[model samples]
Target chain A: MSLQPLACIIPPDLLAAVAREADATQRQALLDTLQLDQSFRVVRAENAARTVETTRALTPRVGAGTPSRSIYDQKHSTATTPGTLARSEGQAPVADVSVNQAYDNFGYTYKLYWDIFHRDSIDDQGLPIEGLVHFGANYDNAFWDGAGHMFFGDGDGQMLTDTTKGIDVVGHELTHGVTQHEANLTYSGQSGALNESVSDVFGSLVKQYHLGQDVATADWLIGADIVGPQLAPALRSMKAPGTANHYDNQPATMDGYVHTTSDNGGVHTNSGIPNHAFYVIATTIGGNAWEAAGQIWYDTLVDPRLRPNATFSKFAALTLRSARTRYGASSNEAAAVKTGWDEVKVRVR
Target chain B: MNLPGSTGDPSGLPDPAHPRDMSDAGLHVTYRRSGGIAGLDLVAECAGSDLPQDHARVARDLLDAPADEPGRGGTEREAAVVPAGADRFTYTVHITDGTRHRTLTWSEGAVPSAAEPLLASLGGLATPQRAP
Candidate 1:
């Protein structure tokens, strides 16, 4: 009488076989039970598949503390990412210069995170670093696809050129992946600006670390090497924010915050506020930017208190907290953090 | 509309009573690309007659399609709500056919396949401009 027991004990195939020989009423019940059991099997299979996918996504593809990098060439087409494998981990340089730049820069970024922060790759799980170069003809931009890949454009030979030439640009895009795996900041409005600023911070740090430059020697410019004649100088200036180029409209302080519908509510424009703050903190600390200053920012990035929708004020306060937590309350690092935010007119309580 | 080679008419016979309006056939398109890593704004404007016949057709078909079409990316509301990607270009395309006008905005990768040629054509014509 109990269909539950029948559904559980009898396999759907056996239940169907039994239904063929049963009485009409019994056969109807058996068929219904078989249908229910079949649905359960589908649900179970789907759940199992989902579990496997989640595990696979979280599982590190390479060994801990080692970077697994792959560089692909798009071959002047926007059709597919990572179009063809031009280089792989521990492989010799290829014929194409862009491929080699991407490969080397990816390694540089990995070294910075690993050597300084002692963190594994982006996800702290040895997530494979994938780079796609030569995407589209004269494409003029570089970006993280938000799905575990970095794409670099060849540039229009006017406003920008050879995006792979900027090591900071590579670090910047890859840091977007790091941010994606961390706070996963909402890429709009104030939080979006924070996301951009974080990228700029780590990006400059990567360059600084590679060059063995102290805060004073570091250029603190985002895309210095990549800009062409049309948009000369650099893409952005963390030290001076709005002075990168003629078209650079970044604002260094809260008083100059630009409110607009374009550029995802001025993410790139307003990021100058935090970018300058980092610049001030690094200079105020007066040593390698990647030392104490970089540690605090990285600490704030992975801190649980840093929310996805964090505003500039929220992020500033968390950085202060990170500074104090890492250093004593009266430590110079914490004081520098406070002074940096105050200089940028961000009130961190 | 009636024409000697017309195949759109439900009847097999050519009808002269409803001639296609030549004025309405003209298309005006404005393309703007913004929000790249360099934060450059580039703009280009063109008339349907200026583009190749195939590209003009694709532009017209893209403008005619509904915003919710699968290949049209997504509705404007959705596009505005979801973040596309970091440092990726955002494109705004406006098309006008006589009195009929439609505008579409999409992040780089979400653009409709049909609009690729039109965008490629316009991108070549684009000049650097500041965002308004």
Candidate 2:
């Protein structure tokens, strides 16, 4: 099956909302974002034909899991050519806010994987983190193009600010890189939903880790900052699915599971099912989310048994097994894992 | 005999949500495309009478062309390849001439390249409306 590279932080539904509310100029920018996304998708499909080794080739192993970072200035253009390197691994802060934010966020993402997962960069191959900021004129999205590059857009300044403003957004896009390397989940149906959910989980985890907030303290909002003020409250709420908008209406369980051909079988919407599940697991374990609950979910992700086309229940089962394996079957961690799926109405068996 | 997964009868084929059959002549077509993360649409309307001689000829030819089966066609395939992480805009082409009317919607990448000029003209006319 043909797979598409994971693309963009802002959900299309919200962008649609923005487009609806926007003036002509802003509306054009929204449409341009949609067009850019399509162009990137095409580029990813073309890139897939390249040899695996060529695409996955590791960067020179940075000694000791230290991040190898490269920040580029797109200068309000959509081109991917990292316009004049603004900063490198050991460089000082740049004058541009977008450049600096991109640099710092890449470091934070690298730190999360290294400190918590004992993994290096995206591929765990000590890959260099590459970021392109200020892409397009008021571009309204960010994406990781299956390859090792991340691109951020300057929002329309009303519903969205700068794509780099959300650290979780950075974590979210980079985790797509991680998922691409590991499971390479098929980007459609249930498997696609799993791919999106995994990114959101780790994205939230990275933010929580950076803020030193446990499950109770963390906001648990995915793209809250990036969505701006006037639009819906948050992008996606793990604690409360479908709270983004009445139209979002993401069900937290199989009972409300959406079966549609759009959004890769409602990957963003149905993801609420698993997102709510993870939230329950973390809240129940009741400490730093990245510790017990986070570890279980991460373990489940890298588990050998997990298939690329895994359904929601299939993923839930893997988490349960990971919990049982890491912390005995009767342990609170394992029980919490079960309750997480149970609350979302996803069968763990 | 219709079998599961069989690519047999055209009617038996799984049609897209809103399928349009433009077999009738003298119909006007309005094409709206929505896909990608923005979930915004590019809305364009074209009528036989509104177009100049050359553009009108192409519009008539395109409208008269055989429509694909109900499932996502060219544009949907292009957009759907990535799955649901983003909104792959679906294209809805509604054709009416006051008598008979039909509506068809498809995702990006599934839209035919031939529809490019037609959509461009309409998109040029469109002001980037939000998807309903």
Candidate 3:
């Protein structure tokens, strides 16, 4: 059979004209080729923009506190990390949507910390943020690898989708690095649950700040976008714990604390208790969550009084102290914090 | 074919609570994965004869390997400590072959290179377990 001319060489207008006169099968083929060609043009444009942004990223900055971010493609292998650098700080979007999302989310998280808390990166030392995406084949998880890097997996498409698609998921993983630098909360028992809760709190705040959403407008659902057909809605809901999905067993109050050794003493399950407290506090304070409720939580995270093994009650007390210290003893913020703990059945001294 | 005394549940997964410890028997492997952002508990199992030949060999070798074998990417101390990152999965594997049996557990960060393929294969078969 004689070879047909390459579709890439044909103009779209000519292709459309030819398709109109062709048989049904040939017409469908031409249409698919045209769509593919259009996608290639879009990708080419994105690559050009990426080149410009990469150049800008390489230029020296006047400020020292700017975020230094890098994203890597794992190529569906879990053998090693920080695999192939796909993008860097200030770089334009790349062909891979996952890389672009990770890069943008990192910037959002950095902006929140710097603009609101004046904290530099995860370490407050302007440490570089590294993210790895497409980790493992059909991998369904994301994590902070204690070693200062973040890893995300392409979900199995049944229960979970792309982990990088969720901005809060990115924030949640990165907050683990923040927690590491500060409280370094032990990842077991109440302390472990507290660690998980802190990540959720800041993760939700990052989403809220990025969207410019107030407490009333925010959905307060974590992993909402990442979930798939098998698990709908979300992984967890700070506003109403235990109601996010079929498997969500999060308890909204200390009275319902789960007693188990699995999942690091049910860290993800029991985090609902503290997560609800933060939600209540933020909603009660009646404004932008990051401005008041977030501030108190952030203060407690970095406070010297916050121990590595802090319990729910201990963390509650510290939040009350933080609110009082920052917003005055009689301020509504402190009272809101106190009320949050009380509602969660966590007695603060 | 099922093992001589095989009593797997309807899904072919051996009962977790009453796993057989028979000596000089066919290969049996059980894998449990937990944690992650969704906080799911997933488990899978397969008899050696049911697995691909290469996977069965690897599973048998894993059962024969020493728990403290070097080059597994993590020491005993590291295994005991909580991994630094959030929403990462923790894995546990139990393997049994003729005259050999071993159980190994590790977080995502400490997974051995040799276990990757086997884990991936088994993870594909995993089903979420309802909370007890």
Top model number, TM-score: 1
Query: Per-residue lDDT for A102 in model 2?
Result: 85
Total backbone clashes of candidate 1, pairs 3 or more residues apart or in separate chains: 0
Instruction: Give the range where candidate 2 chain A is weakest over 10 consecutive residues by summed lDDT.
Output: A49-58
In model 1, what is the error at residue A283, expressed in angstroms?
A: 0.9
Q: Which structure among the candidates has the greatest DockQ?
A: 3
Q: Candidate 2 residues A190-270, lDDT tens each?
A: 887788788889989989999999988998887777875543566678898766643346677889887775555666667
TM-scores of all predicted structures: 0.79, 0.70, 0.77
Q: Which portions of model 1 show Cα errors greater than 4 Å?
A: A1-63, B1-27, B47-49, B57-59, B73-78, B97-100
- Candidate 3 at A187: error in angstroms? 1.5
**lDDT of model 1 at residue A308?**
90
> Number of backbone collisions per candidate, in order?
0, 23, 1
Q: Give lDDT: candidate 2, residue A48.
A: 53
Candidate 3 ranges with C-alpha deviation above 4 Å: A1-65, B1-28, B46-49, B53-79, B95-102
DockQ of each: 0.18, 0.05, 0.19
Tens-digit lDDT track of model 1 for A209-262: 999999988889999999999888999999998888888888899999998767
Give the fraction of true interface contacts kept by model 2.
0.08
TM-score of 2: 0.70
User: What global local distance difference test value does model 1 have?
Assistant: 0.81
